[model samples]
Target: MTMRYDPHIPDRELVQLADAELPAVRSSEARVHLENCVTCRARQDELERARERFFSARSEEFAAQVPAVDSSAALLRARMAGLASEREVPGFWSGRHRAALAGLAAILVLAAGVAWWMDGYRRYPLKPDANLTPGATLSVSREQLCSAPEADGLRVIPAALAGEVFHSYGIRGPKPRNYEVDYLITPALGGATDVRNLWPQPYSRGAWNARVKDALEDRLRTLVCRGAIDLYTAQREISTDWIAAYRKYFHTGTPLPEHARFFKDRPWE
Candidate 1:
């Protein structure tokens, strides 16, 4: 008869290799191997017994080491009193020190207030009465007159004629006339007329003159146009013919003949 080899020998050896934590081997060959492995089966049993003994020893040692907790009111009170005593002694800062601190705080607040006031003064400075005058006349330079764009089509009147016209229009005082001219060149005339039509309306003549005055003041203040030749140097060249035409027809120097006088005091002039 053929003999069947025991496969249990290898399975027993594997259980020993895993320290007795072995999975079941189902094959006949593996069972036969395990059955023949007597040394491996003995090692597996010894490992399992050693593990059980180790766990039982550890459980006893842990039970012995655990401490019992005490709950006495006297101990708790003593601990709280020790903490309170440690905090009771005054350190660097005491009640007298608090007064000094308050004084220092007050000084800081005063300093901040003074600084704020100084900053405000710097931002909004005081001015003299002279600076507040309603109308102040300023000399117009040639460069200013010429700087107006040619496209603006400004009529170039002689300075003398300009003065006369301003006088006729009730812009008598130096201040008012100055203000009037300023108004004319800036927002007034520029806003009202296009390049093609530059004349002021009869009613708005004072306003137009003011605008011109403002323009002249602005140029003078900037120091841009300075001379007589500079006065006529317009970006838009005013033709000599046009100047002559204005001088002849719209002369402010000559009083209009009786039939042409439009208003009672020539208020619009």
Candidate 2:
């Protein structure tokens, strides 16, 4: 039997779902609803696209000007806790005061995120953790990856091995739809079926999410097959920083609409 969501999912809940922080049961229900409900899905898309644009603007335009936050993310979180404690007063529970606290807390959280980004924590969630997923590949010729009938961009992650991947990335018991246990170098490009080549890629964290990377992979494969680009260079570019590779190959500062919407199925899913 199918379940339908009444009204739309709340923006906060949608954000939580996108972040892969939603509870397991609810996440499944929300995904079902998202699949069946175009209105709700469009709303979520708006939120994700807006988030991507914000990150792009920050990275390209403002990153140079914004000095790194002095306080570490941990310190900022502590400060937010301190603010909650210190702001207590008679009648401080009023709506206006509560709103103020919420606003300030949000700022602190954003600051903490920015600090994390500055310190290189953004790489893993957006890119792979180099130490954990340095990428591995089979010794196949370009003709194999480019011309073989089996070179379809499908992925096959073993259940037990996938669990190890989540644990290594410190992501325990994640909802399947929320993150793709993706290969850093895809099989279509001769990627190895090894733990070191895999990472749990969130589907909706930022603009350069797993879907965008899939587009780059397809484009790279096409180029390799067409002799427009060499396989080694394509592999090197993708393994290094796929978002940059997307920009270079697609000749766009941000992802194209078609690329963002494309999804290649993983058999394990």
Candidate 3:
């Protein structure tokens, strides 16, 4: 039999469903509910649309950024020629020295593979987990968010709330030096100061790290205040995918030069 339909599914569960992270049985039940209930189906459709927008925008952006095949082939030829010369070196592969060198090569290859995997896996949280951080915001009007004097700097997240964010993200031990607890929707744009809006964004693990996102937040705030874009639109763009928003606003596939130079890989204090 299908599940009861008295109460609506919680948003957290729906988010998990949207992300395809829910357990099989629970996912099946949610799908059944969605098929039967218009309200839940509509909410599910909205979440799917957001995901579609991110995927569609990201695919288009990366397609335009791909390097030319001829350039890649030329680089490969140069590397292969260098390898050939190294292999022809006299006595380079002799006896015990060869064995030692082989072992070292194996270790180096393993190390490189692990580093590549990690860089691909955790270079940065490309997107915050929707179930954990769906973005939160203050109930402020555009005038309040804009007309008010900007703070001298970012406000310090409360120790308690910071701890909560770490716990929610399943992070253990001391906070990593390369990550910053940042808002999904920045406070400058009226984001709330809650754990739900906060995440441990990598500081400099990749080109699209916290520093790059900071530039986007600043630009969006400026555009909103100047009436160039609606406040809600600014919030949605950043909240959905700041990198996509960055590309859209800056009209560049990569972070601007000034933004790239703005912050170094400094350890978080």
Enumerate clash totals for all models, in the order shown.
38, 0, 0
Q: Order the numbered candidates by lDDT, best leading.
A: 2, 3, 1
- Misplaced by over 4 Å in model 3 are 1-124, 175-177, 263-268
Candidate with the larger lDDT of 1 and 3: 3
lDDT of 3 by residue, 179-227 (tens): 7788899888899988889887876566887888877888898999999
Query: Candidate 1: which stretches are off by over 4 Å?
Result: 1-32, 66-269
TM-score of each model, in listed order: 0.17, 0.58, 0.56
- A best-first ranking of the candidates according to their TM-score comes to 2, 3, 1
Among these predictions, the greatest TM-score belongs to 2
What is the lDDT, from 0 to 100, of the residue 161 in candidate 1? 49
Clashing pairs in 2: none
RMSD of 3: 17.2
How do the residues 1-269 of candidate 1 rate in per-residue lDDT, one tens digit apiece? 99989534454445444443344553444446547777756755676567557755764576467552122323344445445544654576676775565455445545554565444332221210122211222244444334655332243434554455445443343332122121222211122222222222222332222222223333332332343223223211122222222222232333224323232111122
Clashes of 3: 0
| Residue range with the least summed lDDT across 10 consecutive positions in model 1 | 125-134
